[model samples]
Target: MKIALLQMTSGIDPDVNAATLETAIADAAGQGAAMLFTPEMSGLLDSNGARAATQVTDEVHDRVLARVRAAAAREGVWVHLGSLAVEGDEGDPRWANRAFVIDADGEIAARYDKVHLFDVDLPTGESWRESSRYVPGQDTALVNTPVGKLGLSICYDMRFPALFQALSGAGATILSVPAAFTVPTGQAHWHTLLRARAIENACWLVAAAQTGTHEDGRSTYGHSLVVDPWGKVVLDMETTAGLAVCEIDPAAVDDVRSRVPVIAHRRAIPVPA
Candidate 1:
């Protein structure tokens, strides 16, 4: 299957970001891609909590999501809209970093909130407190797409192997990990972690990333990648903010799994006393 990954330097303006996504959807479809994957924070990327709150709204009221859905239907393509920062339920004061899987008919197939919040103080003097503003999701999401059964996750979730293990065990042939990673961490562990996940789980790993400096004065290490089941890097859009397309063979998953047989041999680990 042919898939497109959008590497974006999302800005603070939701409207602008929405337009960018709309165009990318059409472009991807025109290029014969069955699906398009976008980066995290695709709608708005503002570091200023006060300013970003002005644009944040409930999922039903998000203009960017609405536009993207319409575009997806018009183009007749599936879209894995990475992650959008939106308002949470009533009286919750916090927001959600949510990812949506939109079908070709513009209907939402599944929604997955980012389960792992990035709450780390990096060595580069950069700090993040994702839990401070967004609530963590409770469950994992797996959905069928044009490519295959896709497992959903966001930026910080990449660090957790258990999440990928669950997805693979549940018959997921593809994993979608959309991210807006910091430059420091991305440089250190992005490629290594992604390859490891694919190798261990024996699934295709597709990661769409946010690249370049953003309007909010933050920079991301963008290396949107597509790793095959054998942990081969088939496509890599390094540090470029644009759209890139690549072909993925699902049969490779079967080939790798048959050779390794790791998933079948997986045994439950016991807790140490």
Candidate 2:
């Protein structure tokens, strides 16, 4: 299957972002892409928790999601709406950072809430407390798609190898890690972490990324990537708003795992006294 990774620099406006995503989707479909993947916060990027929360609505009422779902059905393609900011609960100050998988019929097949929140104080003088505004997901998501068996995860989730292991154990052959990584962390650990995750699990890692600066006064590292089961970066997107389209064969997953058999050689660690 041919998948397209959309790299975007979205502002704090869901409408505009939806339009951008629509165009990308059409273009991708025009180029014969079977599946299209987007980055985190694809709807909006906001620094103000209040404004961000207000802009997000319930998933059923989110216009961007509705539009993209319609796009998937119209284009006869599958879509991974990487992650969207949506209203969480009644009276709760926080919202949900959620990902959705849309089938060719424009129906939501699976949804994954991001489990690992990005709460860090970076040396670059850029600090974030994502847990403050967003609620963490309690469960991991593994779903089936036309491309392969998918394991869902967001940006910060990539740092936790255990999550990937759990997904792999649950029969996930393709891992989706869409991120809006900060410039500093992206520069330091982005590629390495992604490569490590793919090598460790021997799974195809497809990551769509956010690039450049947003209207929220923040910059992001924008190297969207697709790593094969053997940890080969077949496609690397530039630091701009564009599509990185590549073909992925699921048979490679079987071949790699057959050779390495790492997942089968697992042993639990012993507790120390």
Candidate 3:
């Protein structure tokens, strides 16, 4: 299957972001992409938690999501919209860092919210407290696509290997980690961790990511990559807001699994007492 990954430097405006994304998706479809994936904060990158909390609305009322659904139907391709901040509650008004998969008919096939909150102080003196604005999801989601079973995750979730292992155990051949990683962390850990996950799970890895600078002067690492089952980077969009297209054959998954059989080689046992 031909898949396209979209990397964008999103800002705080929803309307402009949607228009830009539509153009990108159209370009990918024109190139014969059967499926298109966008990066995290595909709609808007609202840096101010307080302001974003007041602006973002419920998923049912989100104009951004509606536009994506319409675009998917119009293009006749599946769209994996990276992540959007949707309303969660009344008082706290949490954000759901969510990813949506829209089928060719524009119907939502699956929705996965980010389970892990990005609450940490970077060595660069940059602090991110995602929990203050977003309510973390409680479940791991794996969606069956025409290509294969795909595991969904966002940003910080990439750091946790156990999640990918679980997704692989649940029959996922492709793992998607849509991220807006900080420059510090991305430069240090991005390629290493992504490749490690692909090699360990013996699954294809696709990570569409935020690039350049946002409205808040925050720079994100933008090397969006697609790794094959054997942990080879088939396509790399390094630090530029563009699309990376590649073909991922499901048969390759079986080929690699049979060769290594790493999943079956494991003997489950308790940790050291």
TM-score of each: 0.99, 0.98, 0.96
Q: How far in Å is the alpha carbon of 102 misplaced in model 2?
A: 0.6
- Candidate 2 lDDT: 0.92
Candidate 1: lDDT over CA atoms? 0.96
Q: What is the C-alpha lDDT of each candidate?
A: 0.96, 0.92, 0.88
Q: On residues 1-273, what C-alpha lDDT tens digit does candidate 3 reach at each position?
A: 889999999988898889877887788788888888899989889788666655588889888898988888898888889999987756766778999988888899999999999999988899999898789998898998766799999989998988999999889999999999999999899999999999989999999999998886899999999998899999889998877788988888999999998787766779998
Clashing pairs in model 3, backbone N/Cα/C closer than 3 A: none
Candidate 1 deviant stretches above 4 angstroms: none
* Stronger candidate by lDDT (2 vs 3): 2
- For candidate 1, the clash count comes to 0
Measured by TM-score, how close is model 1 to the native structure? 0.99
Instruction: Identify the superior model by lDDT, candidate 1 or candidate 3.
Output: 1
Mind giving the per-residue lDDT tens digits that candidate 1 earns over 1-273? Answer: 799999999999999999999999999999999999999999999999999999999988999999999999999999999999988878899999999999999999999999999999998899999999999999899999999999999988999999999999999999999999999999999999999999999999999999999998999999999999999999999998999999999999999999999899999999999
Better of 1 and 2 by lDDT: 1
Query: Which residue pairs overlap in candidate 1's backbone?
Result: none
Ranking by lDDT: 1, 2, 3
